[model samples]
Structure formats: structure tokens, C-alpha cells
Target: MTSTGSTIEPPTTRAMVGASVDQPDAGIARRRWMSVLKHAGLIALSVVMVYPLIWLVVSSFKPNEKIFSDLSIFTGDLTFENYLHGWTSQQLPFSVFLVNSSILVLGAIVGNLISCSLAAYAFARLRFWGRNAFFAIMLGTIMLPFHVVLVPQFVIFRELGWLETFLPLIVPKFLAADAFFIFLMVQFIRGLPKEIFEAARIDGAGQFRIYSQITLPLMVPALATTAIFTFIWTWGDFFGPLIYLRTRENFPVSIALKGFVDAQSSSDYGAMFAMSVVSLIPLFLAFLIGQRYLIKGFATTGIK
Candidate 1:
């Protein structure tokens, strides 16, 4: 009712105020419910994933006769005799296997860090003829499954007289045979600021100097990630040692664990389980130690 006699509607400030207040509350409630569901689902998945490891550890403590029979993880029939028997029953002591595996993993960590990082640096930063083509070819090799070249690699190693030694297991790692680590490092390297390398170059620093000083220090997260994975892979590599190692004395823990298993004869389940648990210690320690770095690498690369 203005002086011009035109009808007008006033703004609903009360309704607007109510809506503004209520929408956030509704959104918050919805988000809270979603978060609850997400957390619950994650907890359930965690239990499911962890149950097998818990079962393995529990079975290690139980006697062979009671392992399958005792469904409960909290079985009262627990003993340390499995560890005693497992440690002593093999032709070579478990400590020998432990030492061999440790050496193998350490060698692999060093090899992958040196070889993969160098390859990644060359691909990511250095200029070279057919760089893109070479990178594409390198990436293409990942599509070629390991089984495809398994026989050829075996024959080559046999011809090179590396078949019966740790050389077969450790040498190719030094040659950057693992494309996965190279790709991972390349991703990490690509994320690094190129200005650092530029500044280093301006100061008359060589490629090696830039790599060692600028790149390597920043690539610690990626390298730790590589080390963790390399250790785990090398440690659990049953097939490699099985094929190359003839003597039981030189066998790593993966191969040594098979001593407890005789398909034709009575298998010592308790001992096998105990040794299996023991074998996982290095992997557990590796992941635990490098978990922060692993997270950092993945977070930076936006890859898991």
C-alpha cells in the first residue's frame, strides 16, 4: 500500500533467518551421519583384514593338533615350543635364513634406491635423445608381465652362471629391472620444483651434484617408500630363492619356511605358522618405520 497504490510484499526476514540457521544444522547432521557410516565401514573392513593376521599369530602359539579344531583366537592352548622347534628343526638354523634374508633385503634397498632414482631423474629432469620415446617404451614394459620373461631371465641367469647364487636374486635389481619403483620415483621427482635444479645449474653444479644435493634430499619420502616396498618384496620372494638357490644353507627365510612343509609327509603346522609369523617381523618393522614417509609420498603423488 504505497502512495501509488501498488500492492507490495515485504521480505520474509524471519523465514530467511530460520532457513539460514536450519540449513547448516541439517547439513551438519547429514555430514555427521555420513561420517559415522564411513568410520563404521572402515572399522569393519579393518577387522576383516586384520583377522587373518590375528589368526596366524594365534595359530603360531597353538599346537598342530588343536589349530583347526580351536576356532577361537583366544585358545587357552598356547605354547612357545613352536618357536623352539621351528628355530631348531631345519637343517640350517633359522638365524642363518634371517641373516641371508636381511642381506638380500638390504642389497635390494640399496640397489632400487640407486638404480630407480637415477632412472627416474634421467626421465623426469635430464634431456636426452628420444626421451619421450624411451619413457614410453619403459612404461610399455610394465604391460609385459613378469611371467612372460621369466623363462628367458632364467635361461640368461643360468648361462651367466648366476643360477645357484644370490646374484640372480640381487643383481638385476641394480640394473633397474623394476619399472614400478622407477615410475614411482618419476612421479615424486616431477612434483619437485625445477627452480632448485635451475639455481644449482646457475651455480655451475653438474647433473650429478644437482641429483645428489637437491633431488636426493627432497626425494627421501619417495626413497623410503621404495625401501619399504623393496624390503617387503625381497623378504617374501619365495619363488626367486626357490628357483636359484640349490643348497638349503644359502636359503632365505621364504625358502627356509618350506622346510617345515612336506606335502607327502606329516607337516609341522605349528612350526610353519611360528616361522611365518617370525618372517613377518621384518616387514612389520619396515612398514612401521617408513609409514610416515610412505604416507608423505602417496599424499604428494596423490596415489596409494
Candidate 2:
């Protein structure tokens, strides 16, 4: 009887082991299938997202008649004439527009970095009176629609004789008018370990020294992120430039692109697409350069 019981136990143990093995295999098969579906979905989405860009690039190369007719982006007969035409057709040169845009973007970046960082440092590190109340007020401003203040802001700028100049666009950034950026930087600065600042203080470092030498270096990722955003915003600001810049010569690439589509004449789609591609180059380059820092910045920073 004992030998029979032992024999049955071995078979039962073998069955249990087989069941365990089968379960794991089933799980692994399901997981593998899920992974494949996920990757397939991502690839499909990527292709969809890139298709318009591919179409634009192809259309830029095609002649007027062939642009919509050509189905294949890769097989189109490319031409440089569209770019040349786009560049030379306007009275206010494309180069002039490019320079204006560059100056505006650079000024905005510099102003936002300096002003926002200072404001953020004060809010995060200092323990002054009504700090929390002030911060809440600042955050509240973000919820207010831009249209609510646009008329007042425009009137103020007009009263100050700031119309028809870049001053109206660039000056407010220096005053930390961009409360969102200030708030973003404040959250980032607050996330940093306090012990480091304390250690610097113990080593006889002043506030400016600590900020310049310690905090600034560690905050490069945040600064880069801010600069990238500011550059993109300033570069693509059509309404601001349209409102302030009276002269055709001061138009940015965004406003200049509109010149390709005139009201009276039939617009040249190929040239319009070509100019559109040209407008994207600077932004693409900016993102490529700062993408690494942007990723790192977002990883460490959050609202306090």
C-alpha cells in the first residue's frame, strides 16, 4: 500500500509541474502577442504622422500641375526653382524676415531666462511674507484667458508708442509677464535638494554666488527647455508681429509665408509648401539641439 501511495504521489507531482510550465508558457505567449500589437500600433501612428510632412516635401518639388496629381512622394521630379522664386518674389526680403525673427526669438529667450529664473529663485528659496498668497495669485493668472487682457495690453502698448517696433513684443518678457514660465522654473528649483544650497551657504557663498555657480549649472535642463519654448513661440508669433509691426520689412517667416497666398491671384501651392518647409527648419534644429535637456528637465520638475 505504501509503495502504491508513493507511486501515485510521483505522478501527481509530475502533473503539478506540467501545469506550472504550461501556465507560464501561456502567459509568455499572450505577452509576446501584446508587445507585437503595441509595436505595430506605434509604427502605424508614426507613418500617419510623417505622411503630411512627406507630402509637403514632395509637393515642394513638383510643378503646379503635377503637385496634386503625383501620388508618390519619393518619385517626384524635384526642382529648386520654387525656393528661389519664394526667396526673391517679395519686396521685403526673406533674409530680412529671417533676421527679424532671429532677433525676436533671441531677445525673448534671454529675457525669459533671466527674469523667470530670478523670480523662481526668490519664490523657491526665500521665505518672505505673503509668499504663498502671491504664488497662488500668480498661478491664478494662468487660468485667465489671454483675450480678456489682450485689448488692455494692446492699448497700453499703443499709449506707450510701442506699436510698429519689437519693443512691444520683447520688453514685457523682461518684466516676467510670462507667469507660466516663472511658475515652471519655480517648481523646478523647488524640486532640487535643499541640502546643496545649505552646504553652499555653510561654505560662505552669497545668494548670487550660489545662484550663479550652483543653482544655474544644475538648472541647465530647465533653462534649455524654457529657451526652446520661447524660441518657438517668438518665431511663430504671427498675431503679435501682425499687430505691432506696420512695416513689411519687419515680418517674420510666419507672416511672410502669407504673402505666397495673395487675395487676387491664384496662389502657388508649390511655393507655399516650399516656404512652409523652410519655416520649419529653425524649429526642427532647435528641438534637435535641446531635446535631451528638455526630456531631463521634465523628468525632475513638477508643480509645487
Candidate 3:
């Protein structure tokens, strides 16, 4: 206490008070520096990753002879002739290939959404003999390489006379042949509240009704995830189309892209690059449209 009976803070106490006031300022400055460094690192990495794509886009606009002659992406004389030439270069217009790819992608997406969701619902909510055993086997198939079954599947399709058709690429989706999608959907269904199922049952809802109405509606995120992934995979599948599609008219965009290269003639790299840029538009649009649901699906399901 001071002489007048007013209390005074000691020097040490005043110093401690000053430190408490100043600590936030120091911390804020440190965080600001950290954020700046983090953003700079990310920007540098993005440039490194996107550089090749930028080059591809630029080269598509450049004269074919100027592609490798000029490594510079910016200094090229740009033209839309590559795109015009590429679209009509093949025996069939490029639109044919695009339409073929669209059909396959749409079929695969619908098939996967229907078949995978049903199978997932069964595995998630139903009880039957050997349920766990079957579920384990389904999960095991995810680890099995697609190549391991490639020959057998090809043989099966050949035997069924389904070769040179979209069936080989899309029908399997209707059978829930995609173990990864099945597993993804199973986890998502399992995440749903059991009480909802019970309430549905109490209201006399049949299993099919519950599945078609309750489950499907709430599983939009997972379904969107499946559809988007199926679109991307089916659209980009080169090996499947190469193996099955024999006629030029039957070829999808993936196979048609490969047609730009011919050993008997000069390659059309400019046209190829231009079509490649065109091919990516659908994928970009799909991702952008379903981005919210894709993130939610992964967040809800067990997949990262």
C-alpha cells in the first residue's frame, strides 16, 4: 500500500501486464508471415503443376510447325484453325466420338447410381445369411487389380457377343461391378441414422419403398459423387474402347484422340492438343457442378 492507502502495482506486475498486452500483437505478426509463406508456396506449386497444361493450350493455338520449335507459350501466332481442322480430320466428324462418349458416360452413371446404391443399401441395412462374408468378399475385390480380370472379362463379353458395343464398357456398371463405388456408398448408407429406418418400418414402409424413397433422396451427395466419378472414368477410358471398338464410327473420344497419330502418315499434334483441350471441358464442368456434393460425400463416407 502507498502512504495514502492507495495500492500500487510493483514493477514486475507492470512488466507482466505490458507483456500480456503485447503478446497478441507479436502472435498476429507471426501468423501473418506464416500465411504469406504458405500462400507463396502454394502459388509456386500451382504454377509448376499447371505449366504443362498452359503449354498444351498455347501449342494448340500455335502453328503445328511452331510447337516444338518454340517452347515459349506466349510468343506464338495464335489461330483457331487447329480446332477447326481437328473436328473434321477423322473419317467421322469429332462430334460422333463426342456423342459416343456421352452415351457411354451417361449409361455408366445411371447404371452405377442404381446398382451401386441398391447393393450398398442391402449391405448397410439388411440382414441375411452370409451377409458379412459377402461384404468382405466385395471389399476384397477393390484390392484386386482390374488387369487381373481384364482377360476374363473380355472373354465373357466376347462370348456374350457384346464386343464393339457400349455394353462392354457400361453394362458392368449396372451389375455393381465397381467395388470401390459400392464400398463408398455402403459407408455412406451406414452413416445414416438407424432411427430413420426404424421410423420408416413403423410407418409400414416396405424395404423397396424405404430404399427408393427414403434412402435415395438422402443419398444425393453419395450419388452425385458416384455419377461424377463414373463420368470421368468412363469418358477417359482408352484401353476398354481400344480393345472392343473396331469400327471408326464406334470409337469414343478416347479412342478417336489416338487416331491423330498414324505411323503411315505424319502426326497431327496440333489437332490432338486442340481436341484434348476440348475433351477436358466436360470433366471440368462436371467437377464444378458437383464439387459441393463431392466434398460432402467424401466427408460423410469413410473415403478421404
Candidate 4:
């Protein structure tokens, strides 16, 4: 429609403007739907992953006869006797294994934190001879399967008189034997600004001082990641404890869990499940506490 000799433009222009505005709203709506779908998939995957753990806890409360027989996690027959017997039936109380595991985990955490951080600091900050080659070798070790060196390592530990002791499990950690943690830390340390180290040195700070005061603080997320992983791995470690720990009294919670299985006659499935559930608590707590740092590092330090 025209007014006078010229066309009135507002209605057509308003229609175009409204169309343009609605375009973005449609795009946003599409994106929202996509986001919802993605989250739904993730939630489903999370439930799938957590299902076994849920089943484990639920099964712990169930009777042994009903453990495998009842496919459903929600069982009617529940008892605390499993926990009581599992805790006390062992030659020593369940507390002994818990205490043993605690000691091993504590030692490993301390060792890895001190050793891996130092190694990372050296690789990231302090430059010396053969640094690249050493770093390359350290990384190469990660590719080597643990089983390849398992026997040799065991023999070395045995020769060192570390058999039948926690040393076999704990000592290598203090020496930065786990290349994964070192690599993790090195990456995190590298992501830190070099200027901090320069400034620290400019202020007459020594290497140790710079490391302790500056890098350590800035590396909290990485360090926390290291500590959390170390605690979990050490706490759940069965191989090292199984190989070195000769007696039930010295066995960690992981090794102690085996005591419930008796092939000759009967296996205490209910009791075993109960103790396994109990064993998971410390790891859950540690992960819950340190998960923030793990997420922070993952977000900030991307393949760096």
C-alpha cells in the first residue's frame, strides 16, 4: 500500500524486524533443545556408571542367598549382621586392615606429593643437563606396561629386603616411580606463568623458596589432583599390597577383602559386600573434597 507518491515503509520494515528477532529466538530454542538432549544423555550415562555402586551398597544389606538370586537392588531382607561379622570375624578386627590401609595411603600421598612435585618443578622450571632427554624418558616409562617391570621391580624390592613390608609399596612412590603423576604435575606447572619465577628470583628468592612460596601455592589445583589420585590409588591398591604383605595383619583393606572368599566351602558375599562398601567411604570423601580442583585444572589446563 502506498501513501501519496511514496510507499509507507513501517509495516513492512516492522515485519522484517520481527522476523529477524524471531530467528534468534528460534535458534536459541533449538540450542536449548540440544542442550537438554546432551544433558539427558550425560545423566543417563552417569546413572549407568553409578548403578553398580548403588547395587553394591544395596546388595550389602541383602542376605547371601538373595544376593545373586534377587536381580533387583531393592531387596526386602536386610541385615546388619553382615557388617558386624565382616568387621569382627577376621583374625584381627576390620579396624586393623583399615589402619594398615590408612598408613599406606598416608605414606603414598606424602611421598608422591613431595616427589612428583619436585620432579615436575625440575622439569618445568629448573633447567639442567639432559632435561629434554630425561623428560622424554620419563614419558616413555608411561608407555611401558606395568607388568613388563613388575617382576623385576619385585625382585629389586626383595633384594632390598623390602619384602613382607609396606616399603615395597610405599618406597617407589617417594622416588617418583609413578610417571603419570609427574607428567600431570609437569603439565600443570608449565601452564603457570614463567614471570612468577623470574620475579621470585629477582627478589633474591632461592629455588627452594620460589618453589615453596610461589609455585606450590599456584599449583594447588594440580597438587590437590595429585593428592586425591594418590590417595585413591594407594588406598585401593591391591597388587603391591598383595605381593609384599605376607600376613593378614599387615594387609590393606584391598587385600583384606579377599579373606571373605573361601573356595573350599563357602564365601561370605554379604559380609564382603558390606566391607567393600565401607572401604569405599574414604575414597568417596577424598574425591568429593578434591573434585573442585580436578575440575578447575581440567578446565584451565587443557593439554598444556
Q: Against the unseen true structure, what C-alpha lDDT does each candidate score?
A: 0.85, 0.81, 0.86, 0.83
Off by over 4 Å in 2: 1-20, 262-264, 296-304
Q: Which ten residues in a row have the lowest lDDT in candidate 2?
A: 1-10
TM-score of structure candidate 4: 0.83
Give the TM-score (vs. native) of candidate 3.
Answer: 0.87
Candidate 3 lDDT at 3 equals: 45
Over the full model, what C-alpha lDDT does candidate 4 score relative to the true structure?
A: 0.83
Better of 1 and 4 by TM-score: 1
Q: What is the lDDT of residue 223 in candidate 1?
A: 91
Model 3 C-alpha lDDT per residue in residues 121-193, reported as the tens digit of each score: 9999999999999999998987877899999999999999998899998998999998788888888888899
Cα-based RMSD of candidate 3: 7.2
TM-score for each of the candidates = 0.85, 0.87, 0.87, 0.83
Query: lDDT tens string, model 2, 24-136?
Result: 56555766898999999999999999999888888887776778777678774878777877675667657888998998998899999999898889899988999999899
- Order the numbered candidates by lDDT, best leading: 3, 1, 4, 2
Superior by lDDT: candidate 1 or candidate 3: 3
Top of the candidates by lDDT: 3
